[model samples]
Structures are given as structure tokens and as C-alpha cells.
Target: MTDLLETVIENREMVQPNHANMLETAHGGHVMKWMDEVGAMSAMRFSGETCVTARVDQMNFERPIAVGDTAFITAYVYEAGTSSVKVRLIAEREDLRTREREQTTESYFVYVAIDEDSSPTTVPELTVSTEEGEQLRRAALENEAE
Candidate 1:
């Protein structure tokens, strides 16, 4: 078993012109790619096996992360099945100098663990060991409902 919090991964990407759209904000595809990479990392952490994305839930972009801003991403495994892991991902636009951030995108992704033979493999059970972990799981569930 693995504690849900143990599967959490957080990282930051500095938005550059190359990752931006015509409006100078982050391109949707680039943001989704970052989210997918982070979500897969969380899935791999929980499963201890290579994970491949199977599905991506609806993604909603609430705001824009402009060039020179930071795209702060947090991904965590909240649920698991025999061979699948469900991860919640959130992206925020951060002004590094001001230490301010606002939600820009949120989504859920499902990944399947793969064995050396390149077949689906069983994953460890996911657990919430502490109050913080429980709260984080609950928040992800609640957000997913919206």
C-alpha cells in the first residue's frame, strides 16, 4: 500500500515565448502536456511501475499564465484500481516576485501501470494516512465533482 500523499508531485515551469500562444499566454496543449507528465509521475510513484495515460478528464482553463510567469503544477494519486491510478492535477499561474498565484487549469487523468512485458500490471492500494492526506483527497474528489 502507498499513502496517497506519497504519490503527490509538485513542480514549476517558467512560461516562455516558445510555450505561449498568440496572446503571449501558455498554449493549452503545452499546459496539458505538463499536466500529463506530472500526472504520470504521480501514478508511477503509486504503482512502482511504468504508467501510461489511458484517459484525460475534461480540462477547464480558468485563467492564463503569461510569459515570464510560473506554471505551478501539483498532481496526486487519489484512487487506484487493479491496474489503474486516478490522478488529480492543478495548474496555477504564479508571479514569482510577488509570491502570488491563481488557479489556471484543473483536470483528472487515469493511467495504467505496465510491467516489463508491456502489459497492464496491478497497482498497490492507495491510502490516506493522515488528516492532511485525507483532506487533500477529499478536496480532489470535491473538485472533480464540479
Candidate 2:
């Protein structure tokens, strides 16, 4: 078994002109790419094997992250099936100087662990051992219910 907290991954990306759309804000594609990468990292940490994206439940973009702001992405494995890991991902826009942050996007993704032959492999069970981990898992479940 893997503690849910052990699967958490956090990453940051500087939103530059190259990653922005015509509106000078970070593009949705770039945000999604970051989410996917972080989600895979979390899944791999739990499974200890390569994982592939099986499905994306939903992606909600609450606001635009403008260029010059930092995009902070967080991912954690909340649930696991025989071979699939369910991940919750959140993206925040942070002003580095002021240290202000706001959630900009959220989503849930499912990843299937794969072995060397590219076949689906079993993954460890997910457990929430800390209060914070329990809260995080509960929040994700509630969001999905919404």
C-alpha cells in the first residue's frame, strides 16, 4: 500500500509569452500539459511503474493565469483500482513577489500502470494516513460529486 501523501507531486512553471495565448495569458493546452505530467508523476510514485493516461474526468478553469505569473500545479493519487490510479490536479496562479495565490484550474485524471511489455500492471492500494490527506481526498470526492 502507498500512503496518498506519498504520491503527491508539486510543480511550477513560469508563464512566458511562448506559453501564453493571444490574450497574453497562459494557454489552456499548456496548463493541461502541466497537469498531465504532474498527474503521471504521482501515479508513477504510487505504482512504481510507467503509467499512461486512461481518461480525464473533467477540467475546470476558474481563471486565466497571465504571463509573468507562476503556474503552480499539484497532483495526488486519491484512489486506486487494480491497475489504475485516480489523481486530482489543481493549478494555481501565484505572484512570486507578493506571495499571493489563487486557484486557476482543477481536474481529475485516471492513469493505468504499464509494464515493460506495455501491458497493464497492478498498482498498490492507496491509503490516507494523515488528517490532511483525508481532507484532501474528501475534497476531491466532493468536487467530483458536484
Candidate 3:
């Protein structure tokens, strides 16, 4: 079994000119790509195998990250099935100088563990060993219920 806390992952990226769209803000596609990478990390960390993104659920874009801002992302495994791990992902738009951040997106991603042949393989059971882990799982469930 893998504890949820052990699967937590976080990353940050500076929204540069190249990452911006015509609107002069980070493109939605770029943000999703970053989320995918982080989500896969969390899943693979939990499964201890190569993980591939199988589905993206309920991606919410609440705000945008400007070209000069920073993108803050966090992801963790919150649930697991026979061969899949489900991750909760959050993205925030941060003003580096002010040290302020506003949530920009939230989503759930499902990843399937794969063997050397790239075939789906069984994943370890997910365990909530800490209060933070339990709360993260609960929050994800509640968000899904909404």
C-alpha cells in the first residue's frame, strides 16, 4: 500500500512570453499540460510504475495567470482502483513580488499504471496515513459531489 501523503507533488512555472496567448496571459492549454505532468507524477509516485493519463475530470478555470506571474500547481493521489490512481490537482496564479496567489483552476485526473509492455497493471492500494491525507481525500470527494 502507498500512503496518500507519499504521493503528493508540487511544481511551479513562470508564465513567460512564450507561454502567453493572444490575450497576454498564460494559455489554457499550457496550464493543462503542466497539470497533466504533475498529476502523472503523483499517480506514478503512488503506483511505483509508469503511469499514463487516462482521463481528465471537471477542470475548472476560475482565473488566469499573466505572463509575468507564476503558476503554482499541486497534485496528490486521493483514490485508487485496480489499476488506476485518481489525483486532485490545483493551480494558482501568483504574483511573485507580492507573494499573493489566487486559485486559477482545479481538476481531477485519472492515471493508469502500466508495465514494461505499456499494458495496464495493478496498482498499490491507497492509504490515508495522516490527517492531511484524509482531509485531501475528503475535500476531493466533496468537490466531486458538488
Q: Compared with the true structure, what per-residue lDDT tens digits does model 2 show for residues 46-134? A: 99999999999999999999999999999999889999999999999999999899999999999999999999999988888999999
Give the per-residue lDDT of model 1 (tens digit) for 30-128: 999999999999999999999999999779999999999999999999989999999999999999999999999999999999999999999999999
Clashing pairs in 2: none
Worst 10 residues of 1 by lDDT: 137-146
- State each model's CA lDDT, in order: 0.95, 0.96, 0.93
Over 4 Å off, model 1: none
Look at candidate 1 and tell me the lDDT of residue 60: 93
TM-score of 2: 0.98
Ranking by lDDT: 2, 1, 3
- For all candidates, the clash counts are 0, 0, 0
Model 1: how large is the Cα RMSD against the reference?
0.7
Q: Encode model 3's per-residue lDDT on 5-94: one tens digit a residue.
A: 999899999999999999999999999999999999999889999999999988999988999999999999999999988999999999
Model 2 error, position 19 (Å): 0.6
Candidate 1: residue 110 Cα off by (Å):
0.3
Residue 115's lDDT within candidate 3 is 99
